[model samples]
Target: MTVLILGLLLFLGAHSVRIVADGWRSRTLARLGEGGWKGAYSVVSLVGFALIIWGFGLARQQPVLVWSPPTAMRHLNALFTLLAFILVAAAYVPRNQIKARLHHPMVLGVKLWAFGHLLATGTLADMVLFGAFLLWAVLDFRAARLRDRAQGTVYPPGTASGTVAAVVVGAVAWAVFALWLHAAWIGVAPLGRTF
Candidate 1:
């Protein structure tokens, strides 16, 4: 639990720099050069993520049951996860309407993903991990939108083809993950519940 908390702090803290201390982050970027800053950021994020995986794994070893979720939550979680994957794909697919409207599809996707997991699983480790991510995503999305407003950022208009492509890509990715990757990597199968 300590390790999990530490990992969350480090990982989320690194992610929050733009939200909490944009000025400081900008200054450091200027001082360190973009490459140096990226290198350091990557290192920290990787270490933090590794710790999160390790700690979460350890915590799962000793299960702590919270409120048992209804069976329907698994199906709902699948739907939420599908949306999350689509939103995530929108974040990368150029000129997608989803990104044009949302402006922060990745963050929204993270929020949905965390939320889905939280709804489906009821355990101390699940709550700690998913709850922290859900909270962080909410805050991060808010901060990012604020920043965008302040900067007068304008996303380009999206084409129908691009939008379709994003959805297709997202669906394929989601299917792949939900079908086997989740079971292989996370030891759980959200889609299997419905299938």
Candidate 2:
């Protein structure tokens, strides 16, 4: 649990810099060139990610139940996760309406993913992991939107082809993850597959 908490702090702390200390972040970026800043950020993020994986694994070894979620919640999480994947794809795909409208689909995806997982899983570690992410995503999304508004940022209008492409990519990725990777990597099959 301590390791999990530490990991969450490090990960979320790194992510929260822009939200909480944009001025500082900007100054740092200026002091260090874009390349240097990115290099440092990537290193911190990676270390945090490693800690999160290790901590979550350790916490899961001694399962501390919080509240038992109904089976329906798990099914609902599948739908939410599917949408999350679509949003994730939107964030990447050029000129997708989802991204154009949302302006921060990736953050929204994180929010949805965290919320869905929180609903589906009821354990101390699960709450710590998903809850923290959910909170961070909400704040980050809000901060990003505010920044966009302040800067008069405009997303390109989306074409039908781009939208279709995003949907396909998201659906295919979701299917693959749900069918195989979730079970293999997360140690729990979201789709409840026996294999």
Candidate 3:
């Protein structure tokens, strides 16, 4: 749990610089040069991610149930995950309708993904991990929107083709994750719930 918390702090804190201390991050980037800054960022992020995975695995060894979620919530989680994947894809696919409307599809996707995990899992470690991400996504999304407003940012009109592509890619990715990757990587089969 300590390791998990530390990992979250390092990972989320690194990610929050733009939202909480854009000026400081900008100065650091300028001082270090873009390549140097990115190299450092990547190393930190990787270390933090490794800690998160290791801590999560350790925490799971001694399961601490928080609350048992309703079986129906798992289905809802599946739906939410699908939507989250679509939003994630929208973030990368240019001129997608989702991106045009949301302006921060990736953050929105994180919110949904965290929310879905929160609903599906009921453990202390799960809560800490997913809840922190959910909280961060909410705050960051609001902050990003505020910054966009301050800068008079406007999303361009979206094309149907781009939206279609995003949907297709998202669906395929979601299928892959839901079908095998989740169980293979996380050791839990989302669809094979026995509870």
Best by TM-score: 2
Superposed Cα deviation of residue 41, candidate 1 (Å): 0.4
- C-alpha TM-scores of all predictions: 0.97, 0.98, 0.97
* Candidates arranged by TM-score, highest first: 2, 1, 3
Looking at candidate 3, what is the lDDT of residue 120? 87
Which digits, one per residue and each the tens of the lDDT, describe model 3 over residues 50-154? 889999999999989999999998999999999999999999999989899989999999999999999989999999999999999999999999999999999
Candidate 3: clashing pairs of residues: none
Worst 10 residues of 3 by lDDT: 186-195
RMSD (Å) per prediction? 1.4, 0.9, 2.0
- What is candidate 2's CA lDDT for residue 122? 96
Instruction: Tell me the tens digit of each residue's lDDT in model 2 across 1-195.
Output: 887788788888989999999999999999998999999988888888888999999989998999999999999999999999999999999998899888999999999999999999999999999999999999999999999989999889998999999999999999999999988898998999934
lDDT of 1 by residue, 58-138 (tens): 999998999899989999999999999999999999998999999899999999999999999999999999999999999
